[model samples]
Target: MTGSTGDFAGRRIVITGGARGLGAAFVTALAEAGARVCFGDVLHDAGAALAQQLAVQGHDVGYLPLDLARPESVSAFVEAASQRMGGIDGLVNNAAITNSGGRLAGELPVQTWDAVLDVNVRGTWLMCVAAQRWLRESGRGAIVNIASDTALWGAPRLLAYVASKGAVIAMTHSLAREFGAEDITVNAIAPGLTEVEATAYVPGDRHAYYLEGRALRRPQTPADVTGPVLFLLSGAARFVTGQLLPVNGGFVMN
Candidate 1:
């Protein structure tokens, strides 16, 4: 869509994990579309560099250090973003952790599950809660949680990651219902085996398998998912809520 047609002009957006990967792509895209972007991430160097680059390019982009696993850190990050951006017009819960234990659900250790859930599920919940309060007061907001295709189609070895993303999907629906009354839209995007540094650990065979069934016959990239995300957060999707839009290159039909 043209910049004038895009709904993000003069809007304020907050993105977690915005230092790199898909989060970085989102920040760049949103800023280019005229959204004032504030992002929080633990990668201090990368975050600072990206923020500086965007600023040099004449984009309203800010970066803050955040640790999603800590409630205090989450609160501080949200508060600072809200204060700096003059309240949030959109929130993207994109920060997550993937456990590399590679165990079956029954064989997974308690600590492994806790570690993944702490950052992926609990962190997302906290961010949403904090943003909801501000959105309620502002009377208009949009949230787009980053889910995974594995949440819909189970992954054998990544049990913890799958479970965490599944919970995110469920939470999106529940929050959408609760926040709808306050004029806030809540939804999720489930990407399938997107090309990112995090996916470097993915088995080559599994990557090939994911690509084999796609009609496009190619691995997905960060740019592949950004369009759908921009749509969901825009005025074009005002009536769309409580939905999970999968940007997985048709890897899984559902």
Candidate 2:
């Protein structure tokens, strides 16, 4: 699919946490693929700069401020994205946050747990709810939720983040059934420990373990995670739903 960049021409999509890292990669790749894109994130300046940069390059792209921890903000983001793109055909649930590294479940405070679950889990469902009608209007709507392989392999030293992603996988199945009759497909993309700014806190040894254990024996990049997301958002994945696709270079293969 990388051979042609306009496969998604005319498609309108909304993505969460598109200010940087993997989210930024999705935003960039989708826009270059000819999709009308609107992405929301709490990082106002970064999001705006990315949008402006893309727009200057002649891509139909826009950005808005969003705090996924708040219900009102999630609803506003969906609404704003719909208005920007004229309509919505897809939604990417990518916004998430994690506390400092190497904290056990018991060591973590309740507030940390609440914050992660609030944005990673609850925010995802709220986005789907708010985008329901707009997706239905598109005839065939697709939703791609960004999950983590940590949940699949029971990665150690991560409590709240793992639990939240596990919930995302389950929600995908349930939402797929709920949105099926409306011609909406729900799916999740589970990526391994990727090399993003957010992952910089990870220990050097832990990162080495990831590279050594994976079949590819190399690091995973945001670019590597973008193609599968694009496919899941495209017509090619119309028959695919309620499934978790891992993009971790053969790490944690099932």
Candidate 3:
């Protein structure tokens, strides 16, 4: 999926947590595909740098500060992005946290659990609500929620993160049904433990588990997941919604 494809030419898109890792990859891919993109992240500097870098490459991409934990921030980001792009045609809910990991479920603090849910579940919901109107108005809107394979595999010591992703998957189903009337498609991609900065905190054993368990032996990279995302947001998937596509090298076959 290079810039030459231009499948998303003239499209207006928004992405969350795009300062680095998978979000950054998504931003680059989408922009190269000729989409006018607006991406946000709590990492203000990184977000700004990424936007500038892409801009230098002749891509129409903007960066805004967004903390999904704050409803006001979510609302403001959406409004600003919409105003900047004239409207939104696609949304990628890619921001999430896994602070609850590396601890026993019973040892998880209430604050930690609450924080995870606030950003992962509640944040995702707010993004959808805020972008609803613009997406509908586009008449070709698509949403791609970033979920995790851990939710489906029941990864131990990551209860809160797992639960939050499960909610995202469930939300995809309901959102698809409701947005269907508006000609919007909502779907999810549950990626495996890919090699990204966000997952650097994960234990080596967990990484090994994923590598050893996959039908494909090679370690997963950000590029491995971007193609499916592009397809879902493209015209080819106009009729495909309420679906969960796992890009984990067949680690957990559905």
* Highest lDDT model number: 3
Q: Per-residue lDDT of 1-254 in model 1, one digit per residue for the tens?
A: 23232878888899999999999999999999999999999999999999999999999999999999899999999999999988998999999989744677788889988989999999999999988878777655889999999988888889899989999999999999999999999999999999998888888988999999787899899999889898888887878899998888888886
Candidate 2 least-lDDT 10 residues: 1-10
lDDT of 2 by residue, 136-220 (tens): 9998699999999999998888999999999999999999999999999999999999999989999999999899989998899
How close to the true structure is residue 114 of candidate 2, measured as C-alpha lDDT?
92
Error of 2 at 96 (Å): 0.5
Off by over 4 Å in 2: 1-6
Output the worst ten-in-a-row residue range by lDDT, candidate 1. Answer: 1-10
Two-way lDDT contest, 1 vs 2, winner: 2
lDDT of 3 by residue, 1-254 (tens): 22232469889999999999999999999999899999999999999999999999999999999999999999999999999999999999999999998899999999999999999999999999999999999988999999999999999999999999999999999999999999999999999998999999998999899999999998999999999998888888888999999999999999
Q: Any idea how many clashes model 2 has? A: 0
Task: List lDDT for all candidates, in order.
Answer: 0.91, 0.91, 0.95
In angstroms, how far off is 193's CA in candidate 3? 0.3
RMSD values for the candidates in order, in angstroms, are: 1.9, 2.1, 2.2
List the candidates' TM-scores in order. 0.96, 0.97, 0.98
TM-score, prediction 1: 0.96
What TM-score should be assigned to candidate 2?
Answer: 0.97
Candidate order, lDDT descending: 3, 2, 1
Report the backbone clash tally of model 3.
0
Query: What is the TM-score ranking, best to worst?
Result: 3, 2, 1
